[model samples]
Target: MPNRRIFNSFFLGGFECSSHRRPDGRRLDLLSATGHDRMTDADYRQLSAHGMAAVRDGLRWHLIESAPGHYDWSSFLPMLRSAEALGTQVVWDLCHYGWPDHLDIWSKDFPDHFGRFAAAVARLVRDETGPQAFYCPVNEISYWAWAGAEVGRINPCAVGRAGELKRQLVRSAIAAIEAIRAEDPTARFITAEPLINVVSGSPEPQHIFDAEQYRLSQFEAVDLLTGRIEPGLGGRSDYLDVVGINFYPDNQWYLGGSTIPLGHHAYRPLSEMLEEVQARYGRPILIAETGAEGSARPAWLHYIGAEVRDARARGISVEGICLYPVLDYPGWENERLCQVGLLGEAEGWEKRSVCVRTASELRRQQALFEDVAAPEPATAAE
Candidate 1:
């Protein structure tokens, strides 16, 4: 059997560390709101106890680089140290939907400043931790483009300029990847984006084309990063590394109507989606983020897990799955308890309680996969 690379664990805990500007121009820091920022030690302990050996987390760009070219590692150092002590591997998000206020995202300087900051981060992490690192350069280029540029729902607040913003983000991400690689030769990158299916509401050719185009648009960011499309943004084939697919219950929907009922005639099986991604890029893939709120969380994981197993059975290098927002946090638009995490917040900032139902299901699913050993790759097609 060929040597296979896997993350430290098949299960990962993803902190909801979104630091983004809301529609009202207010900067929201979810790490602070959930108290995870101040409770790194306790959080790491809980993660290890729950058999989560890897995590997806992020740095608050605005806080660290309060001024141009200045980064305050004081805020992030503790978390890094804690994760290292706990033997947890981390995939950090360099730009989690927010950046320094002094920088103009539209200006050419955005990528320049971001690249410099990324290089500096790589150096500090390499020196302090002395291990290979993984990074998602920008959290979700696709969703950010639509929400921030097209709808005027977030920062940069540009209406009808999503394509332009996406190019800018791709430029920044490419620059960051190059800078980080220059600092640490072995750095790996994961591009996190929503994977979806779109269907036309009618049988008209135009409607069909619209849906097909909408579906294709989801891959634009990754395509740009890979030089498969939009090579002008300094994208190249080397820049595209691992791919992280973020899926939710509502991801599959009619182009102009309600959510597509799963298992319906039009609903695409996630196995097919994973296959399309593999056939397109042939890179390692991870279900970077998947979760649900309330009682549906465990069932959602079970369903996705089974699909992932099926994908792997087809010889896809589908990697481990991640439960994003492993700890419940407030909703972005409202302070309402999202209840989407495997763990629930406790009264004390440093403590959390596992959602018993989700935890049980996770163990059951883990056992289910373990029972079926991974089949050896076929050396010759029969």
Candidate 2:
């Protein structure tokens, strides 16, 4: 069992800070679109009002690095100051599927430039916060590779290049970790990847094999980072530090079929999945992202919270559950309102309406988990 606590709160609010460009060539700045950039102080205060003291946020690399080797912290400083002032611990995402337009994703310079940018950001964070910092170096490398390189749905929209893109992302993540550690040796890292299950309804052997292979592919990026398969990428066991799994309702489906409904026999319990992750990595785990839309929010939280308790009771070192996009945001492709947050969309400093049901459930879970002893603070130096 792990003896150290990884976050200030077991329940965390995650800001959707994706800045990826759409396939139509329009860049999406979710922070501004959802008014989070203008309401950082209110956001932190709101999280505190709901019994949360930790958050998962991102640094917009595209906004920060306007020119090669140059950075402007104008866009990120205010949020950092707000979190620090309000005593909210934050896990920062250095690259969240967006980068400066000048850089080519396939170029050898990509990782090197990313390393430099990460080091600069680390230095800023170390100076603003302290020795202890948590960072998800690159968000969802597998998903990014698939969406951007494989399916041509987003920027760097190249078909049939996901393998190349995945390797590049792994390299970039290793570089970021190395650079950040150089700036702040005590900084802890989290690798957030989608937790998925692919089942095959067909009796054909090839179909079954394909489904299993697809399911296992979810671990590719983490494996590459841990040097489990690609030692030449400068990966090491420590680079895989804290395992962050992002789960959602649509995460599981049959090979050529629809989603496996929550209670179906084919639906795997989240506790079972967490056990697999912990057993494989022998490291702390975090539900780095999890949430549902509309009326599903409260029940989803209840279900996830319960499973987390089950995992903990079995001695799995599950650290925390983050309500990703804790505030609703505009959809990535359609620009439709995604009502998936505990708080709804708002303008400027206007107070956002709360999802009363989800907030109440969150409070209830907080009380239930209260009996569990809080562990000592965790650090990379541990």
Candidate 3:
């Protein structure tokens, strides 16, 4: 029954470049050829103006070390300085996806390579910024493994080896955590992972089994991080301080021939997910990422607010809810980046005309949910 504080801010990790690509097929332009143009100071100032107290930003290992023992800090220093100046705490994501193009994902040296890289970043950030910075060794381990290794969605897209990918990801996370902690023992750790709750229309044995396996696969990383898995597989809970859940409305799915509307997916309320994670891991939970894709943001905000309220009433330590990609970008998944931004893209940014209608809607939704009070707990005497 740990007490939790509501963390208010828009999630901005993916927005910053860390040698990763957006859903729109755009790679982050954080660093230039000279590695001189990393995340600018103005970015932090703008985010702080939006009333942001925290930011999820990146510290890429590959960018720091294009080759072994070749460390570079010119690109990342500004990011750390900007966060400090803006008074914004950061959840530093070490590895968002794969390493630099030069390194292979499945190479045997990958884990140790990443470990050294992480240690270097942690030491640099700690020496320069002190020990208060938060760190997430890797972002969405399960999702990356499934999408990259099993589903063939991204680079090195291998298939049918979900277990192998999961194992490697878990080991990588553990190694990264160890490396960071070695430099800064008091650094806070939050492991962000997608929480997929799947539901099928068919009650047939095969369908039910598939649904269960899918859900189980989603939690594989969590189980390993939280020490719930059997030993000998690198499943140790020593570094799992916070369980970060990146949930989306599309997480729940109806199987079979059911014709549920695209927006009517049968997802579990965020509260339910919060409670389950707390019960299982006994750690504070943060909705590391969550948001809807559309102009009807008021309804989306209200729905998510209701879910958070429900969870707070149950004495769950629901720490925060971050709206993913506070701003829209172009070229998302298959060039179909849905309008999932609080603010629409600027006019010249993409070929599609900017949606002016989203401006008022975004303002209204932000106001509605800005100061939402968590539901009060029930009295035992009642």
Candidate 4:
């Protein structure tokens, strides 16, 4: 039987925040309101008691490097200390779709500057939390590139700059990973890229080709990190240890008249996608971020857990599943953080204990993998 450890997974809560000043000259606090005061310690312990193995916390570049060569780790240190004390590991995300405004994104110095900041953070985290803690150098590189450079939705928004921004970000990511590894060779790194599945419209060959191209663009970071880039672009293999897939129900799409038979509420099955990534990358994979809409979370969790079990039965090294945005926060897409968390606002902290049918399904799926037969090798032809 395949080992049962492969199916064990849990949620990691928390979000991004820069330790810089807000427009009104107020220092921004990333912790939720209920977590805002001296009570954050109690909140951290509460999260641990509710089965969170780790918390995906953000350490913004602007915050760390407020001025050239100047840093203030005072604010972030406490959170890390609390997490460690609670026995919850941290997946420290270095950059989350933004950077210090002082640095020009298109300048040659950007990558080198980012690398220095990353190395500093790695040293501090290792010194404080030890070697086993995980690090995500960049969060959603593809999405940030596409959104800021291609779609023009964020700062320095520019349309049709996807290619340029993607290259820059990939280089930055590699540099950061290399810097972190330099500090601690055993440092675990996971690059959390959005797993977007684009289906073609009309079932026409051209549409299919276009959709494939789109999908390839999203997978480019993984390709570059794994040293499988096309001949023209340079590739870096040393950084690609784990592929972190972040998928939401809304992350998939059908273009040009193609219909996803799966309802808007339905999510793409995890087993098939997990197999594809494993077949292509040949490395352990983690569902770095995945969660259902609050109202349907019970059903969503059940379906995802089953999919994970199925992937394991097929011999994929599926590591863990994280329920993202475990606590409600502000400033999400359309300002709807409550929609994604396992707990609804009305339930408050009680949402943590609110187990739905999905919990039972997850338990059942875990049981199935406990004694399953070894899966056949995934052949290229398959």
Candidate 5:
């Protein structure tokens, strides 16, 4: 088994830091909505108690770069400091489906401005926190492409432009990687994208072919980044670093049909999926996002934990599993409370309630993976 000391812990917490504009033009700031922005210190402290010393968080690009060529780290500095103080390792997402309104996504200026912004962020983070850092330059490129261009549900709402938007995002990510490397060559990256399985609802040959094609589309962004396709975008094998897969219960579905229920004949085991990804990329894999709402939370985590163990036993370098949206927040489309986090919604940190069931499950998982995580090397500071 590959017992690499990648993350600080085998499990990770993830704050919902989505900063995207709705199709109707209303901007959503999940960090603020969940009170994480105000309770950064408290949030990190709580995660530490839950054994999540590492976390996935975001930098609100729209807030930081409200104007072109200008960055106001005022929106992000506190969060960075809080993590440093708490000794929390963060995979900072530079762009989580949001960008400055002054820039056009389709224009060449988008990547140009993003590269500069990423370089600036790298310098600041290195100055404050030290040499080692992790970044997800452009989060969920595949999903963002579909949401923004194919479905017209988010920014740059353009129908049938997913291909164009996807390429643009790839270019932007490559540029950001290049610029950040110039600042801190030791920086790591997480290319997070949704992992899905699509099965044909019909036995017809054409239907099966279409379903398979749609399912394979999930790899488009990673392939572009690896220079497997579209080499003109300046992607190289090294550009694709850690493979971050965001899996949800609803990820697998039948083409043109409803979500495929678990245990159904066509339902694929996550371990097998992990194996396929390992075979393809041959890089470290992180379950960068996975969780369920309310009553389903414990069982969902248990399922993923078991699958990850299975993958690891098979020699797949499964690095860690992140419980995304570690705190509950309001829904995107509607403001309904989504009970998907281990920590429940609260007006203040004192009022927050930890989901006992989920927390217990997490502890149980930690115990299971404790032997899998290698001991950390002692730091001079320690």
Candidate 6:
């Protein structure tokens, strides 16, 4: 077995459990849609077979809290129990771009109320599964802001209010952290944000500055959490625990232009990006979400694993890399089958089906990791 720190395994599987509504106002339950919710035990067992001892999943806020001050754990408890039974450590995501229908996001007490709910969740988990649980409150604040506020892509479907949405998400997350600590002090939090690089396409100096600034905007969420940039949101150093970053092939681009894929001339190396993140926050990092769709899976994984290996060689404390949405599911926009996950949809609730090539590649990487992670032999005795 590999000797691993921070998590039981160096690799983690993430499920796409987005409960957000589309711009057309139709609610999406990706977990249920993919049958993971109904097949928790099998899902976890399948992940464990792939050597993923840790997983990143979500608890649908809207489904959990149907009414104010009340919670229905019908959809969550079973999944938690399944993970425990399968010996899979989980980093739970609370509020993944969706919330209770009765509550207004812009309301004055949103943060406080969210904090209270988060506290209750912490207590529930502690009472059920014991301590040292991981949580990501209000997942991807910066991305959510851009999606929901800037482009009206998702719920709360507002436009021209990116700053406002960001501030609110940070406030809610901060408040939730405090509330959760009140319930369980040993609980760890993950501030998951995108790590991207942008370059200027224009020769104008102002354009260059704008592009760079936009790149820096990716750190605003963690900056607020650590009180580095936006202290007004009540962020403190302690609030920034394990820094989680999401990266994909399309992460880099030229400002006002096309995406610069990995290995392109203008594309930035992921190792350099990881180094910058370490320099900025001075905390351990987890590649919370990363994967490519269809035939790009194997190559993307190889690239990411190499980058992470290089990052660690440079003494960066990169804890793990997660194959996000490790199970193939319907797309949020058009419900198309995204063949990204290592596992495909199962025919039944107890048996799990997998993508063969994906599974092979995953195991190949696992064996390689084990070789590196194994301890050295004993020295010659006198």
True-vs-predicted CA distance for residue 107, candidate 6, Å: 1.1
How displaced is residue 3 in candidate 4, in Å?
3.5
Model 2 alpha-carbon drift over 4 Å, by segment: 1-3, 347-350, 372-375
Model 2 Cα lDDT, one tens digit per residue, 267-319: 99999999999888998888999999999999999999999999998999888
Model 6 scores a C-alpha lDDT of 0.86
lDDT by residue for model 6 (58-125), tens? 99999889999898999899998888777788999999998999999999799999999899899989
Per-structure clash totals for the candidates: 0, 0, 5, 2, 0, 0
Better of 3 and 4 by TM-score: 4
Pick the winner on lDDT between candidates 4 and 6.
6
Per-residue accuracy of model 1 over 1-382 as CA lDDT, tens digit each: 1224456767788998888898788898998888888988888788777777778988998999998888898878998889888878899988989998898999988888899999989998899887468889999999999999999888988899999999999999988998998998788788999999999989899999999999999999999988887677788888877889999999998888999977799989999999999999988788899998899999999999899888888888876789988989988888899999988876576668889999998888767655332322212101
Question: For residues 113-152, what per-residue lDDT tens digits would candidate 5 score against the true structure?
Answer: 8999999999999999987689999999999999999999
The predictions' CA RMSDs to the true structure, in order, are 3.6, 1.4, 5.9, 5.5, 2.6, 4.6
Q: After superposition, how far is residue 22 of candidate 2 from its true place, in Å?
A: 0.7
What lDDT does each candidate get?
Answer: 0.86, 0.90, 0.64, 0.65, 0.90, 0.86
- Deviating ranges (above 4 Å) for candidate 6: 1-4, 371-382
lDDT of 5 at 255: 95
The residue pairs found clashing in candidate 6 are none
Error of 2 at 36 (Å): 0.4
Better of 4 and 5 by lDDT: 5
- What TM-score goes with each of the models? 0.95, 0.97, 0.82, 0.83, 0.97, 0.95
Give the winner by lDDT: 1 or 5.
Answer: 5
Q: Once superposed on the true structure, which residue ranges of model 5 sit more than 4 Å away at CA?
A: 374-382
TM-score: which is higher, 2 or 4? 2
Candidate 4: clashing pairs of residues: 201-256, 201-258
Q: Is candidate 1 or candidate 3 better by TM-score?
A: 1
